[model samples]
Target: MTALRPAPALLEAAFEAAREAMVLCTADRVVVMANEAARHLLPSARPGSPAPAPLPADGADSFQAEHEGRQLYGMRRELDDGHHAWFLRDHTEELARTTALEVERSRTAFLAEAGRRLSASLHMRRCVRTAVELAATHLADAAIVVLPPERRQSAWTRLLPGLPVEEGTLREPQLGEVPGLLEALGGFPPIPSRWLDPSQAPGWLVPAGFGPVGALLVIPLPGNAEPAGALILARCGPAAVFTSEDEVLARIFAARAGAAVSAAVLYREQVDTTAILQADLLPPELPEPEGFELTGAYQAAREGLRIGGDFYDVFGPAGASTDTVIALGDVCGTGPEAAVLTGKVRQTLRALRLVHTEPAAMLTVLNEALLQQSSRQPRFVTMVIGSVHRIDHGRVQLELASGGHPAPLVLRHDGSVEEVPTSGTLIGVLPRTVVRPATVELAPGELCLLYSDGLTEARGGPTGTEQFGEGRLHQALSECRGMPGAVAVERIRQLVSDWVRGGDSDDIAMLAVRAPTRTPLSLRGGGAPAQSPYVIAARRGDRRPRNF
Candidate 1:
């Protein structure tokens, strides 16, 4: 405010002409003269009376008070003749504006914090719990969040101060018993607080031991396609009745909580769907035939996902049959998209087995079937499909067809690894894609190995970029000369894993089929030949094969 002083002659005219209310007083604290504004502002302070209480106390220079319901500001200014003037003005509008600004700031901060806390929850139940807890703490005396009904029951979470949150399923909630709840649950606009009578609230809507309700607020938590649920807020006494502004803030808060709960519900649905997908796409347990042991290992390229491009399955022969169908394949890429194609290939092969089970014939039919897909983008699968047969004299024979896949390796009894020459054109591409079929014979102590390219192509070494070539894989297998099928497969997988050392990798899969070796009573050549540790473990029933 600008400095103001009045000339003795012009003081009365200045005080009267100005809009400000001014009262002049003597050193004795007695009122001497007053302007029209001051006379109207303080009707009781006349020329002969003392000043009113609106004056600043304790010799203060300024004061603020309420006069006849109007907010007033007063200033004391001293004059040269042992007199002073009290300048007063109505400042109701300014103070109200400041108070409103502060209230808005508080509401904004509250909403921001609420949004942060709500969005952090991904589980639907936890999100509901958090919503009710927050509302109870800040918006009302108690709160409850009710989810959509299912199976003739509705799930609810409720909270109150100094008490653990409560949750349970209510059999057929009577929403009509509570005013505005049915409308809110239907996603209609909320009803004003004044319209609801606390005494009419249903007992189930209020937590136990809580006194009579003062106010109730019900609002829907909207979702992407439908309402996620509804929120119920209550106050304990008449003094806490929600104002119009309080209702508006509650609505805004409900909007944020609704969005968060909706997202959480959507995420949970996806997780459930993914679980089903993983169960279907996961490789089946490899069947162990008499005198034939098969073990396999698999790891998807995408972390946290169980299904990937690489896959393997073993179908044991029916009664009296000697051959067990084994198929291991890798799609072009290494994620869900490729895994889908891998699944299609596996299912198509199973379906085609009724038509033609021969390795080459099955490949031909699968190639034609894949080429018939409706996808615009090209997709192909590299596979090693074959059958394991336990022949006479305890030897195993393997007949397989390769479709643009890495050649299979045969581990010899003397620790020598030989690669089978069965590389062919990748399936799902050329209609006349060549299918190269090969045959290998495993001696009593030998084994046949089928694997995906993720093994030899794993990238890591001292330089962290070197590929674990076939030479390293072969050398690793040489160490597992007399090990069981599962042990050999695990050995190869472990070596590849070490080679990568936690670096990015493609989908890896390996399968090994070993012929049983004879275990003798003595270490010498007296009875049967000395058995390997794997065979001893097998006899002890402790050889647990890896789950495919």
Candidate 2:
């Protein structure tokens, strides 16, 4: 049997009781029919205004319509009668919820990406720029990062290991600006981020090409106790203005960005401080005397950027050109205490230079000074103090004295290396010293190298536990004859560095002095050359400060 279709009256009753608004309009824009819900929902659907267009065949689009100043979302369908049937629902709430969820997701992801970008560099400016760019891309049309003056305390605030302990003064605030939106923001404070009402925004804001609507947020960047900086975000009119929720998210982002930027600031300050401290602890440029070529290298232990106690210096007597002094010494230990003792030892030796003519006598006086000083902890020092005097055109005499230190190496004019046989009790270890001067005359193309035990004692090899022995040092220097003083020093430095493979090691200090193969042309001529032609002077590139 065939099923009977529903009567027209039954269909009409069902349409009137339906929840969705329904309307039937002829193609020419005249309403042919309407349900009670449709009439109540869209009063204009009763007759002609303009018929809503039919929905896309794929049903992938919705049209927004306004009735009674309320927003509506619906679709239109083509009926068999050549008319259009419009089906609409009150979607304002659902659309609001979905848009909110999407925005929330975007914000979460943006913050995560911002964190990654901010932490990617230890540079302060880069971190600030990352934060501003991220805010502009996700939170607002424009953004700004403003930093307060740097704190005065040591940059050792961060608890993380492997960070440098540096200190630097930040005198002015730093600000980061977004690419656009200056017009909307107008004039911002030079050092701080502050909010402004749209109506009262500075004159430049609107003229600067900021968007239609104006809303601003100034979120203070949180630090350990006080704020390190502030973040400013702005939006134009008609756009979703700043809401309390937006402010909350902005504050959260500002907190993380602040931490990263603060850390970067601390790191940069520490680096600078470390450089200054090392400069003070290490010898300045090696003195360039007519008879000698000098170069040196120093490396601090891996603990941090702070300088260790190993020290070296080459200085000439006040006005005497014929004789110069060379000193290399290591205090009993490392860290600030050793550094202090190193400085004291250097000062004591410098003062003793005037009174003592012999290297052995000078060291005897230094030993007494070391033993007399009162410190929280007792310290001893091993040192080699030598007096270099020009004997003739092609020869130089080195009078050396050692106190419990490695014997200085001599790379002779011939392809041979020998250690100066000098030894004595360590300074600060005995009431009387046993140092005696050991004199050796250096022919042209010979070098006298004094170094700390750090080089020969660095432990790393195939098994990662072998000490770099004097045998290796001897063999290495054997090949360095006739080389520039700077080249010879660098060869040893590179060799030790490679052997250690960047592993933990003690401080390394080296000083090499050579009698040039040829007398400086300036000495032969009437006056000194404008610049030394020695490759030793040219390759003296190690003077550039080391980064820890």
- Per-residue lDDT tens digits of candidate 2, residues 348-399? 8877776645678877888788788887677999999888877655567777
Q: Say which candidate scores most in TM-score.
A: 1
TM-score of candidate 2 against the unseen true structure: 0.66
Structural similarity to truth (TM-score) of each candidate: 0.88, 0.66
lDDT of 1: 0.82
Task: Write model 1 residue lDDT over 43-155, tens digit each, in one string.
Answer: 87788788876875477899889988879989999985789989999888888999999999988998988999999879988888889888998889999888777897788
lDDT of each model, Cα atoms only? 0.82, 0.70
**Candidate 1, superposed: residue stretches over 4 Å from native:** 1-10, 66-70, 80-82, 319-322, 354-356, 521-548
